[model samples]
Target: MTTKERHKVLVLLGPTAVGKTRLSLELAAAYNAEIISGDSMQVYRGMDIGTAKITPAEMMGIPHHLIDIHDPQDPYSAAEFQEQGSRLIEEISSRGKLPFIVGGTGLYIESLCYGFQFSEAVADEAFRKEQDQFAEEHGALALHARLEAVDPVSAAKLHPNDRRRIIRALEIHHQTNTTLSASHAAQKKESPYDLCLIGLTMDRKILYKRIEDRIDSMLADGLVAEVKGLLENGYSRSLVSMQGLGYKEIAAYLAGELTLEEAVILLKRDTRRFAKRQLSWFRHMKEIEWIDVEGEQNFSENFSKIRAIIAGKFLSGLEYTSEQYN
Candidate 1:
């Protein structure tokens, strides 16, 4: 590949349980690439079951970065993830290996791919606590209405139920005297890398079924026991990791708020909703070349199709040995 044609990163993204991890391993093996996880929840340690983190065997001896790097109690923001993930990408590219960003977190992927600039002002813990308490008492919508008064552009874009982002925007306005929408608009003007984006999607029904099955598998694979262990280890239910979709529902069930069967049903429903939201996020990215997994014959067939696409685009006539990369 010519210097101009060489991409700094190849991103493989899709909703949860769309088989991204397995396909990413094959692509990395094919292209002399290193995998850098784009998952937000997978960054935390002890979040294995809920996050659907790949096991050592599942990784197939490939080196993966940005997984299990943070403690559950430690706060990890998108800005921090972008900084660390970008450094890893740079380091990998400098070594003549391609970096494969693979995960379902659209925001994290966008932040790294575009190099979103964060404010210099530090987060005000006291102010954040106050805001959190207010939101808790008045409800997320009421807090979002308060944000509407300050940054209507952001408030209009974000759903009131999106409390995390709402809180973040409010906090940004309070700390930096600028709206998060303004910062996002400014950041959207430039991207750090010459990006090649690959998005995988499936039929909605199949995707939903896969998500439900995955959640069922998680439960069968000791998901409840995993959360139980965390609780026994002194991790609070209010921690960010515990609030993840599967973890929260399972924890609620363990705490006697719901029966196990009800928790499973809720988990499936929430996961489907999360997948829909993920698709909505990816739909807005115009750079992506989407692959339909629903019609693919099998994993290998799908892998070959993606491999051919990448090879034609980036590796045509390159006499590189795949064995050297794997």
Candidate 2:
């Protein structure tokens, strides 16, 4: 289908601490758009600090969706994100607004962008049970190592604590004798929307410093207390929600598996690794117009470049009434 025939969707995505939130808010205001959060953890209520969730005051009256709609224990998947995001795209477009998605979750964002076919991985009960038994015997990390041996691509995207998906990816390999990533690559990535896919990047040194600073801020904002409260409320540490970045490390510290200092060190290290993996995933994705934001002191110059890219892609013929960049 032609570009004019497809629905328009704007996505702002990148690794953590690359300034996606600030840019997304600006772009949304400029284009009269509603945002759908693409982060997996931000969908859960009470995960604000760790997820760096955008606050009401920060939203600047922009309508945002798919955030705080799920309790910590409720399961969410890429398939679900695609369904809801597609519906929201149509609804927002019908209301004469653009639909924008913003976050660092590569799989969730890419699934929505390309309408990825996920049904190719057939279920294998016996294989899944065997892997589960192995994980129980060895550990989630060991099981993840097994996956890394076969499907390194999928392994890079999944966290070691995410046993379910790791097991599923392993099962796909076992049942079909093909790596899960290969299966995904085999799909015809035909997008249903006229997509403006923008990616933010920065020098690794600067990005790492920003990540460490952000983690420190989250700790100061009571990320440890938040995890403790959830645990006190009888939430299982084994729950997928509890296994997210800050929650997992803090839970470990609280459980006496690690000291506060040790947990902080581990969290910072893991987060850096996660950011690297996020970039690796997005680099493999197609059609992203990358903007290097390093050395742009106040991000004013970077914002202008991004805005111009958006305007050229989606607002070519129309006059724009954009908010002043703060």
Candidate 3:
């Protein structure tokens, strides 16, 4: 299909705390678009402070989709996000408004953009149980070492603590005699829409500082209280939602596994590592138009550059309804 015949999608992606939220609202208003969240953690209810979820006031009256749609116990995956995002794109486009996806969850955003077809490897429950037993008896690292022997690429991508994904990767290799990385590489990654992928980047030092400051603000805003509430309300510390970046560290502190200072340090370190990983993922995607905001604190100038890039990509003029940002 020609570009004109395809549906248009505008995506703003970056590492956490890289100013995507502020820019998303401005772009949404200027392009007369509705926003769809691309973050994995933001979908859960009552995960506001840690996820840095956009408040209703922060939304500035723009319609945002896929936020607070699930309880903490519910499972959400990239496949589900792809399905919902595709449907939302269609619905939003049908209404003569642009569909804008804004967040930093690389896998979910990439899967939706490129229509990634997940592997069809059937579950091997016995193998899963065996791996669980191994991890329980030996350690997560030992199980991870098994994957490192067979699929080093996947092992590198997964954290040592991410036992579920590590086991799942091993299961795929065990069941299909193929590594997860190979499965992904074999898929024909092609987008179903006229896509505009924008990525924001900045100097590492500055970005890391921003990350630390953001964590400090989250704590000051009662992140510990939020995690405590979740735990008190019977949310398991092992739940996927609780295992997210801010939630996990804070939960550890709440459980007395670590002191507040230790948790804060770990959270900051993990966030910096996560940002590095995010940059790695986006760098591999060839379609992204990267904008460097390094050392530039002015929002309007950065916004103008992005606006021009979008207009050039779509070959159309934006409405420019609003440009002022807080």
Clashing pairs in 1: none
Candidate 1 lDDT over 220-249, as tens digits, reads 889999999888898887776777888888
Regions of model 3 farther than 4 Å from truth: 317-320, 323-326
Compute each candidate's TM-score over C-alphas. Answer: 0.88, 0.94, 0.94
- Clashing residue pairs in candidate 3 are none
Q: Please give, for residues 13-55, the per-residue lDDT of candidate 3 as tens digits.
A: 9999888988898899888999999999999999999999999
Candidate numbers sorted by TM-score from highest down: 3, 2, 1
| Poorest lDDT segment (10 consecutive residues) of candidate 2 | 317-326
Candidate 2, residues 1-326: lDDT per residue as tens digits? 68776888889999999998878887888888899999999999988898999899899999999999999989788889989988999999898888899999988998899988885666778888899899889998999999999999889888888888899888888877898899788877788888899999999999999999999999999998999999998889878888899999999999999999999999999999999999998998879999999854868888888888887887863335565763
Look at candidate 3 and tell me the lDDT of residue 162: 72
- Model 3, 132: alpha-carbon shift in Å? 2.7
lDDT of 1 at 111: 88
lDDT value for model 3: 0.89
- lDDT (C-alpha, whole model) for all candidates: 0.82, 0.88, 0.89
